[model samples]
Target: MTSQIHVALRPLWLCRACAAPWPCATARLNLLAEYRNSHVALSIYLAGMLYTAVEDLYRLNPQDAPKPTALHDRFLGWTAPRAPRPQPSD
Candidate 1:
């Protein structure tokens, strides 16, 4: 006797109406994982921006709100774009 394991990929809309548990099961699992990852990334980005904005507001009285230094160093290091080069004098 021989035994084998097989995996199948199915669309979520089809899987939802599937009567067989196995077919729907894997789809649900994958969908859940994808949702979790997206949620985490969204939460991190929102929190980072919110924190930075609040910090900048607190620093506004001193006229320091618009600079990049209000945000976390690590976030700034990762997301901040490079400065443009100075134009040459004619």
Candidate 2:
């Protein structure tokens, strides 16, 4: 019952970390741990809903792109279609 919901949402918890949602790492960790208790299941569900809203906001704002770095670029390159490079000019 509640356990099933927790299990289903475990990935979303990890996703929030990977996405680096607001409130900083320590605060997020505290929130997650607190929400794990059965008594706090409702809190967990609400947090998940809020996290979804945050992700939606991100999707809406292309200009607020995630901080770009070489590692991110490489990851994108792996997933994205590649174009042929032009030859060096003489």
Candidate 3:
């Protein structure tokens, strides 16, 4: 069987599938598995989401907002990019 969509719950920022933090343990595992061969795309997608989450979260705490570094690490800093593919020769 397939897994359900694991989007964030927003506001509270929990995982829709597991109810953990957004990009929670289960979501992270599934993301890595799905983009195992294409980490760049995953990075791009996460970066975009990070931007949106940051914006929304900031509106909620304009004075006590989390640091950019913290948010970056939480959203996009954990994973490294995928390795390059080998070229085929004739």
Candidate 4:
């Protein structure tokens, strides 16, 4: 049988593969490999996911909604953009 893909499970945003949070470690690593050539694209994609997650999670439990900063950290913090390497003198 094929293994389940690590995808989000709707409003809950849990990973289908491991039942952890969506974009769990494995998912993040996969995303990095998929978007390795374009950090900007990765950032844009993650930002969109973050927006959707906030909407779904907040609606699911408005009274116990997660903090904005915490959500930002969880959704976008780990993928800090890489800086270009300095050139050596010839």
Q: Compare the candidates by lDDT and give the number of the best one.
A: 4
lDDT string for model 1 (24-60, tens) is: 4554344345556575564465356546554555555
Off by over 4 Å in 4: 81-90
Q: What is the Å distance of residue 28 in model 2 from its true position?
A: 2.2
* Residue 85 C-alpha lDDT in model 3: 85
Whole-model Cα lDDT of every candidate shown, in order:
0.42, 0.43, 0.83, 0.90
Name the top TM-score candidate: 4
Worst lDDT run of 10 residues, candidate 4, spans 73-82
Q: Estimate each model's TM-score.
A: 0.27, 0.26, 0.75, 0.84
Q: If the candidates were sorted by their TM-score against the true structure, best first, what order would they fall in?
A: 4, 3, 1, 2
Model 4 C-alpha lDDT per residue in residues 1-90, reported as the tens digit of each score: 997788888899899899988788999999999999998999999999999999999999999988999888878988895588899989
Q: Which digits, one per residue and each the tens of the lDDT, describe model 3 over residues 1-90? A: 976777798875678887876888778888999899998999998998899888888998889877999888878987785577888988
lDDT of 2 by residue, 1-90 (tens): 332112212322233333433333554345456755553563545455555544654576657644445323322223324689899999
Per-candidate count of clashing residue pairs (backbone under 3 Å): 0, 0, 0, 0
> Considering summed lDDT, which 10 consecutive residues are worst modelled in model 1?
5-14
lDDT head-to-head 2 vs 3, winner:
3
Clashing pairs in 2: none
In TM-score terms, candidate 1 sits at 0.27
lDDT ranking from best candidate downward: 4, 3, 2, 1
